[model samples]
Target: MHIYVYFIYLIKNIFILQYILEDKEINVFHKKEGNMEMNKPNILHIFVDQQRFDTIGALNNPIIKTPNINRLVKTGVAFTNAYAPSPVCVAARCSMIHGQYPANTGCFENDLMPLDNRQTLMDVLTKGGYRTHGIGKCHFTPDALALKGFQTREVQEELGVESVENYPYMEYLQEKGYKHLCEPNGVRGEMYYIPQPSQLPPEDHPSQWIGDRTVDFIKENGDNNEPWYLFSSFIHPHPPFAPPNPWHKLYRPSQMPLPNIPDEFESLHTFVNKCQNRYKYRDNGFDKNLIRTMKAYYYACISFVDYQIGRILDELEKTGNKNNTMIIFTADHGEHLGDYRCVGKRSMHDSCARIPLIIKQPGKFDGGVICEEAASLVDLAPTILGAAELKMETHNMDGVDLYSLIKGDITRKYVFGQLNYNGMDFIDADADFENYVTNKECKRAAFSTYMAANSDWKYFYSAPDNREFLFNKKYDPKETRNVVSNPFYKEELKNIKSSLINHLKECGETFGIEGSDWKAHKLPPFTKDPDRGLLIQDGYTPWVDTYIPGYTDL
Candidate 1:
């Protein structure tokens, strides 16, 4: 019996060593194959909504305790500078599925469809012999075909009863005292005293259900020997900031630093800042303490989401496919969390544009390699399809294939981003929306959101007001100073503007205007006065300071 026990122990150790050796050989085998995986390593794309770049523990943030994500960082490639192509949920997720920029897909605004069926990444993957699946929020319009692609198991209808429309399972949860989900607004909604529904234990949360379904899929397919793509989409840390119980108290607010709310940052956002004063959470009926508690709860939501991810990872490992899987993690966009005194993702700043992207290509890539090269969420579909060796020829994708860099090809110079003032358009459709509709607006005026590489020389242009924001990321990653007007850097400004123009042109984005010499009307400048109706501040024209409370003013 003693000899048998020793023999079994030796066998277990041998198996563990073999696994480690196999992991090391992944990259070598990939290089040798050079774009060939026997059946294409199984793809697991984990997408979360409204997550910021600094929220995870392994990244620069030491405050947020995200153990699972930290583990992912230790064992995968963390793309430090990954950005959303558009800073809105529906738009960014559409880009992720199609590998195309908003301009190419025409789903440039919230509440819009993908515009064409031939464009989604699922269409490509399905044609490639891979089974695609999705779980969680489907915010896009006409979600029918999309659900069919993945055999989606999502919570339809709104999540709470106060909602004008019934979310799929919201009524069920609400009747059981999950009332907080019905509160239209969270801390920002100005409804704090509203009693929160009893926090759902992690096991009962919607995210957990999604994880279980994914586990089932993995187990069923683990031994089938067929490559699969499972997109487990979670909608936590997005709203009400109500991260259920236990999770709500999981982290202490004092330990978690307040977001970098730049002093007088509200002044920078002339449109949103003005409206904020008219609708404080207190005036809307939330208790002051409730608001504070909700803020803490939002952070808790982040931590809770992180915990769910840990659960999914455990399932992945337990199923024996962890070694051959290529797991891609990212978010649609980011939540402002009061940064710049903004509550949501309608701005073009880093807080709204920058997001986290970590990819774990087991056996094909190593852990601890941080890639600082700029990457766009739009590049996601192409990268995944390329890794799966699936042809993306039929789809008119605007993003570049980024699989090489994931396999250790990092000679990339710059990544690109675009903007749509979608929310701004809601406020002033006649101004910006008219341009996109008539195709007359040339630059930022006609678009919603915009971003460019965080190069030593960076330039931000708003086409409507002909406004320019120029900064040197090498000197100021925070983008506090707008040096577009500094005459000392005139040559550098001109060069960057030229490059910007060339980039747009290369992507087949024509403004119908010529040359990089175009400059904003500088003298006397555009301005708004109390006497002149609304101020054309922050390059947004026709922007009015207004608020329309939702939930019947509950």
Candidate 2:
């Protein structure tokens, strides 16, 4: 037993010793046999940032190609009604790990994270002897070298790593002299949604770097029989809408579908849309041709990530971990992709909240069945623990096992979400617009958006607006029309509102209630400082118009 080596590992990130410790040397790996395979299944959680639910090819969205994700859907159970815990990244991700709501984590925005002392899914699994390692982004704020129970991590955060010496991705870029081409998180500010190919080659792209690192990890640990958990997180399909080489030109922009701008619902009228419409997707200058151009790049980014997944899947098969591992794929939150004329996330709309969830474990369940039950990122902790045959140590988790939902042993009546919201998800705008969101009597400063949905209905309420929006998914799947004012659906609205209130109460949110009855109260004013993720570096130039004509218009 390498007891002394584990102490060394304890000092220097536990999973780095993953290469050193194997088998029962420290009891990290069980002796793999028939029964052991059933008992200790490996977990590989593939998480992407800002990917929308409708991008997968097999899922019936014709606009994009995602062959590898389609393979997962073909071989796994796909949850069609999955939603984010909250519509922003950090809130949704922290809630995911803790199996709690955003309010419980006190992270309605990216500014905060659950206290470090809190027991999370990764912590519990590590205690259960899983060798946990994280690659790519976690986006936990007050950015630490280690947070969220990942024994060791090679982060590719949108924000620059505080310790580039320790960050493997950054170090690699530096070593290869690709630092000049590295935008860290692609280009930011005005170019966030613009169509451009990455300056780096395909093999050197950040997504490719992650893919290679994961493949190498599998190769290094495959024969060790370690019951390992690897969070292979990717940073693509988020923004800058850039792909490298052939992928950038993989699609024709003219063929891409236009954004959903419903006539009945003016997106500009919403709080979030107003903040996002500043420059990247200005309402006046953003024509359908440019929207199509952006969609082409967006789809290209997703397809690039998909290719990386294919590499990981192939590696698992080569290492004979294919049947022994339980694979889970999901995103932190969905991207708006110009839905409702909004460029980025922080909306309660399906375009921003709904995500694709696929789980595959060999011989446990039927494949290719689209599980229609409501699911959220908050449910991942309990679900993954269930798959690993371990129990969650956290007492305040707010999720049920998704396997139960699929098997009909339990059902979720609705999936609910709330986000205090943000300023264009921390991207910059003109100074005047910034002042409006921060200092003025803007809607975002005063209201938080709350949402509740099931297969039958989608509901939203913004307190300061003193309005409610209800859309029947069956009749209006795109949520093009608000039926809250219609007398025909008054009873449904009443019942849905009652359900939402009870949910909030259950989650210990008393702010939305007044004496047992549901009531909307104007929230406290947003403070002057907003959490702009990864503050811009020095030598900033103003957003310049490229004047590149879209192929659709040409």
Candidate 3:
């Protein structure tokens, strides 16, 4: 009996090794073949929301402990400079699905969404004889479960009450008798940064549910003879940095470092940046303690998520499909975490734009390799489709297949982005988009902003402000110095501006560019109302209201 068990274990390890060391080149599978799943590789895409680039312990972060993410970094190829195409929630998520920048997809902000006409990577995978399933927060518009391409999804949107019907996490809580104890995604608004423990236990938290559901999927499909694409999305470390019980106390505020809140950072802010600051409550009474505690809670939330990730990974190994799967991990965008005295996303600075991207495939670099190339979320779809060895002739993807990038077969000189201030990510953003963009008098609060970044420099142009910034990432990895006005770098600024213009023109999103220069206008920026409270207006009811569960005043 001992010999038989040992023999089976040895065979399983050998099987894992053999498949893991398959040919590096991605070969197409015959879609018409009945047993196509037998030859093709499975894909696992793990997504997190609003996680910054420096949170991984393996990635130079000494304060945060993320062993599972570290495991991925140690075993996969990690890219140090992956940026969101648009540094907001819906836009970046849409770009990942549609394989295009915001300009092309017409979903440049939270208010917009991927139109049903667009072909998604999941759609292509399903058509190519692979099962597609998404679990957790997708944040798609019109209908949360609007199956753009996924065969099905178990949604755990941020706010549980508003997206209540058919919401698995909420139903789980309700059935388990924990529904009255907690609100989704933690308490919100002015208390967004306060450190708090989750009302539910660690095993019952939404993050754990997402992980549990994913593991269950893998277990059920392990021997199904069909390759699959599973997108496991998590909503945490976004805001209200709440972690369950012990995890919430895992990190102390003293251990968490303060954000880069430079003395003059407020002066350096753009129109949209300033508005975001006021709305997020970073404008008043923000200090070192708050930032430190916020970081502590944020790290705790991440550690919790990382713990869940380990469960998913273990299941993959037990199912013996670990090596046959290509696991890609990334976030929609990043958080400010008090960087530049800002609290949330909606800026082109590295604090908000940069994301963590790690991809693990078999037969790759020895232990793992750290890639220094500049990558973007827009590249996600193309990479997935390429890995599945499937192609759709009807659509043109804005990003190149990442294998070309990893192999150094092609080099991307620049990754460009467009911006729309989604007005701080409120639920009814669509109803208020026009209101925020331009008032009745026609003065625009948010302008047409564009960004371009390569290996050395990062540039942004805000047409309404007639403001442009150029940061020498080579010298200022902190992105503190805006050298756009430095006469010594005039030519560098001109060249970057030209490249940005050409990109906009090429993509047909050049509303603020004319001839060879950016269009300049002296438009008034968004101003604060002295009497304005948390509510945008009196008697206004948002489709989804954010409040502290036990305490409502905040």
TM-score of 2: 0.84
Tell me the RMSD of model 2 versus the true structure: 10.3
Put down candidate 2 lDDT per residue, 1-554, tens digits, no spaces: 59998888697876666554432212133343433433577899999999988889999987688889998999989999899988888889888988988757777777678665888899988888888999988887766466577788887766454345767777777777653543655677656666788877898888998899899988877866458899999988888788888888899888887788888557324665555565343544557787788889889889999999999999999987886788899998887777776778877788988999999876553467798788999899998888777887656788888888887888767878877754444343556555545642253324567788887898887654556789889998998888888999988988888887788777677565666554543343322333333234322111222345886457
* Model 3 TM: 0.87
Best by lDDT: 3
Residue lDDT tens for model 1, 88-186: 777787777778776666565565665554546776777777777666675666653245355444443213223323243444345555533322223
Segments of candidate 3 deviating more than 4 angstroms? 1-22, 26-37, 162-164, 364-366, 422-446, 531-554
Q: Which of 1 and 3 is ahead in lDDT?
A: 3
Pairs that collide in candidate 3 are none
Arrange candidates by lDDT, highest first: which order?
3, 2, 1
Ranking by TM-score: 3, 2, 1
Per-prediction TM-score to the true structure, in the order listed: 0.76, 0.84, 0.87
How well does model 1 score by local distance difference test? 0.61
lDDT of 3: 0.78
Candidate lDDT values, in order: 0.61, 0.76, 0.78
The runs of at least 3 residues in candidate 2 whose Cα sits more than 4 Å from the true structure, single-residue gaps closed, are 1-38, 267-269, 279-284, 422-445, 516-554
Q: Output the worst ten-in-a-row residue range by lDDT, candidate 1.
A: 535-544
